[model samples]
Target: MAPLIVNEIISPDTNLLIAFLIGIGFGFVLEGSGFSSSRKLAGMFYGYDTTVLKVFFTAAITAMVGMLFFSLFGWIDLDFVYINPTYITSAIVGGVVMGVGFIMGGFCPGTAFCAISIGKLDALAFIGGLTLGIVFFTEGYPLFEEMYKANYLGTPTMNELLDIPRGVFALGLILMAFAMFWVGEWAEKKFPREEY
Candidate 1:
């Protein structure tokens, strides 16, 4: 079984088939989870519905814990996994831009796509705006390229930066997620909104 598992080869056709299946599952789950509703997603910022926050944090923590467990068990190769190369300036600037866009547009890229797929006209307009924003970014890329590429710290994780073990970081994240979940539950009761 170990030999079969380690030596298993996926043909291009099989890989594409698996990719399609995974994509379909992802789309179905997103739609079912109310992610296809921009208002539901935007409600996180308004303290109306906190489902988005709960789902997102839960997913993040789950993935973090799973990856850590996989590494501990030697089931996955951590070294082969790609990590984001830190560019301090770009990270700050990009985060600020994303925050502003979220506040103004009330939809992030993935949720906007999900909403668009479900025939939300607002999401369609948001997508149009996103395209324009992308075009503008591309046209202005040269101007920002230097700053964007500056202050590079190669693939540094929070564990490496803070001198903490990955498991400890993952555990902390889980605790934080639980705290957020509790707060989200309270907020939902404290500030209830009508369901659409």
Candidate 2:
């Protein structure tokens, strides 16, 4: 039932169509959640609002739990799932770069697109810069190839890396998420902001 396209249950075209629909739905949800507002998103950094953090944490935990249960129920084959190969240096560099971008622009790439759908001028500018960045990265790939490929770690899930059972890892993450939610609530109360 899972990986319908790969399993040949759904045609490639249908897979792409589904992806497009999902993208539209995702953008709609983002906009509805006030994610299109840079002020709201930036509030997470200022400790005045933690909606972004909570939303992302919830999403991560939900997916982790969903996959674990799906595997247990044999609804999906965990082995068929793709895990990205880790390059330590590049991962650190990429994370730092993205973090800086999020801080400065107050929007991640996906949210930028979501904002653009609502005709946000700032989002347009962000997307312009993002496009330029992409072009620069593509053109400069050769010069950055060595660093990008450095410290290769074969794809491994957190449970695998920690030598723990997946269920145990999922439980630990769930608890962590709950704690973060509490912290987020405290931050919002401690640093109140005017409505955006």
Choose the strongest candidate by lDDT: 2
Judged by whole-model lDDT over C-alpha atoms, candidate 1 comes out at 0.82
**lDDT tens readout by residue for model 1, 112-185:** 88788878888888889889989998999999999999999999899889999888888888888889999998
Steric collisions counted per model: 0, 0
How many backbone collisions does model 2 have?
0
- What alpha-carbon RMSD in Å does predicted model 2 have with respect to the real structure? 1.4
- After superposing candidate 1 on the true structure, give the runs of residues whose Cα lies further than 4 Å from its correct spot: 1-13
Off by over 4 Å in 2: none
Residue 1's C-alpha lDDT in candidate 2?
26
Per-residue lDDT of 175 in model 2? 95
| Tens digit per residue, CA lDDT, model 2, 1-196 | 2366566778988878888898888888889889999998889999998999898899899888888887788777788787899999999999999889988999999999989988999999999989999999999999999999999999998999999999999999999999999999999999998887
**Relative to the true structure, how large is the alpha-carbon lDDT of every model?**
0.82, 0.89
Evaluated at residue 160, the lDDT of candidate 2 is 93
Best by TM-score: 2
- Please give the range of 10 consecutive residues that has the lowest summed lDDT in model 2: 1-10
